[model samples]
Target: MAKKLFMFEKPLGMRDTLPFLYELKKQVRSVMAEEIERWGYEFIETPTLEYYETVGAASAIADHRLFKLLDQQGHTLVLRPDMTAPIARVAASRLYEDGNPLRLAYNANVFRAQQREGGRPAEFEQIGVELIGDGTVAADAEVISLMVALLKRVGLDRFSVAVGHIGYVNALFLEILGNEERASVLRRFLYEKNYVGYREHVKSWPLSSIDQKRLLDLLSLRGGTDVIEQAKTLVTSEEGRRAADELAALMAALWTYGVAEAVKLDMALVSHMSYYTGILFDVYAEQVGFPIGNGGRYDDLLAKFSRPAPATGFGLRVDRLVEAIGETDVRGDIECIVFSQERLAEAVELAEAKRAEGKRVVLQHIAGIRDIDAYSQRYRSIVYLLGRGGQ
Candidate 1:
């Protein structure tokens, strides 16, 4: 009878990141956490599994895509597809009652069912921060500056923070359509970056020539501070104007912080965060086609858990960040590798002494002289014979 062969394989959209990549990820995360801490953000953690309803509110996560299961008691649960939702739930349940602006940070693994369009793993790491109870332009500006500093700290010299206003987009759509279903459809199309589909959908509506032009103009808005002025003319609702004003204030604040150069405004950036009600942004690095990080303001997400509080945050995809940083082999300084049989005790003592002095040392038993060269090359080690003395 032939032995059964159980093929080793990863589940679809998942993969095992080997040691080199894992180490690189660790380095990137360490730098990010260190820099974020410097800005006075305290770290927090949440569970990997959340109640299904907690994360299901975000339309970006389809029901089929969520890894859902029933607990032993028959309660529906899911592997959290995104950290923001669980974070919001936390704020509502625990932090909101405090009535203070909480600057919290977190580094955790987030599992998503969909395959990454950039050819990355489905289960990846996210290093994120949430600023709750804060809605001031100063807060937004600080967050953007901190994000830029983090990217620079992680060795990404060339990157852009694409800023947007979800409030502006929602306000404009509602002012024109008055129908929730139509606006929802338009929002989805814009979120997907399907400009062609958006235009086609708007064509069927009874919008005036001016409104039509404004709708298209909203999609066209992208660049720097000048984009804010351009957006002012296109906005027709009070919420739209407020969003534009917020963007202007945020830009001015960024200028004062001396980080304006790192930011780019894009009115069409409809992020997938359903709770986002104000300024939103995503970070993109040069030579990397996808965003390495993204975040925005969510004023009402906490209300679902019965404690309403304004909040904003950004999540850095550590795996993608590791990819952007590329592979870097870490080398260690070799002090000694002792080889001996009869003098094994002496070899061990010598290795211990070196280690006590904060030096790396390796101990091996040698059969004969020929084994020395082979062991040295195999372990990238330096061989020292006990009887022969130092060579």
Candidate 2:
């Protein structure tokens, strides 16, 4: 009997990134790392699989959309759907004794079970950073400015960083509704940018005319620092005032850092993650429909690890970022593609020498002219024939 040919297929909603996409991913990560290192943030890594309960506390991943399984000990484990939760676990268990304001970064693949409508893949790479132990406006400013710098470094020259305070939105809901469940529902509506749904959700509430006006006003809050003045009028609670003040200070600091032009304010902006306790934000490029990166202060996340330290972070979806940047045909400048049949050793030595001096070299064996030209056109490689001596 003949043996059957074996082939592998990727799971649903997951894909094997091809070579061009992989190169684009690498470039995006390199740009992110360079920008992060400029801000004195160090790199770190955590396990891909985590205790189910640890991530279960986060509303972002608590849902069954996580890919879960049982461990050898029969304990539930989950492939992390996001990076921040794992980073929080790491900070609590490993770096708990470290000094204040630890800045750490990571680049890793995260897995999630897509609900089919989210239009996102189940497995994707996230390049992100965490700032722990500091919750001051200065820290927020530093992180935001670093984000701006990173985006600029990555060739996203026409992007904007839309900043908001979750506290402001939470405070408004708490003051008007005083019901967590109702507030969560409204938050979901706002997060989806379903202004119509938000209106419908609030219609049944017994909010006063003033509260109704305030809520409606928030939906239109977008622009520069001037938007904060409007935010103050929309939020009546003391907590709301504090959130606005923090945003004001953050805007001022960004101006001082010469990044104000790249920053914008959005009072109604809400993060999908419910743990964010303070400033929340997302970066948007004119060319993309969704955010290229997002993050916010999750002062309460570390508490889940039993340490209760304040923390903030942001992450770039490297794939989406590269897509926003558009693919470049970087293979066009290839100056040499050395071909060898009998002189493999010599070809390899010459290729290595050229590569060491920063030259692009491809060493391969070709049998005929047609094959050589085909390979050259495929890779946009320049052909160099190696014969007996120098012909």
Among the numbered candidates, top lDDT falls to 2
Each prediction's RMSD to truth: 3.0, 3.0
| Residue 60 lDDT, candidate 1, scale 0-100 | 39
Candidate 2: tens digits of C-alpha lDDT, residues 1-391: 2343325655667878877777777877887898798889999988888888776555366576889899999998888888888888888888857657889899999888976754578888998888999979888888888888888888887888888898999998888888888889889998888999898767667788887877778889999999999888877789999999999999999999999998889898886647678998889886788888888888888888888888888888887888788878643334555665767777777778888988766666665445655566755556565676576
Query: For candidate 1, what is the TM-score?
Result: 0.89
Residue pairs that clash (backbone atoms under 3 angstroms), model 1: none
Tell me the lDDT of model 1 at 250. Answer: 95
| Global local distance difference test of model 1 | 0.81
For model 2, how many clashes?
Answer: 0
Q: Against the hidden reference, what TM-scores do the models get?
A: 0.89, 0.89
**Runs of candidate 2 exceeding 4 Å displacement:** 1-8, 115-119, 179-181, 332-345, 367-370, 378-387
Please list the C-alpha lDDT of all candidates, in the order they appear.
Answer: 0.81, 0.82
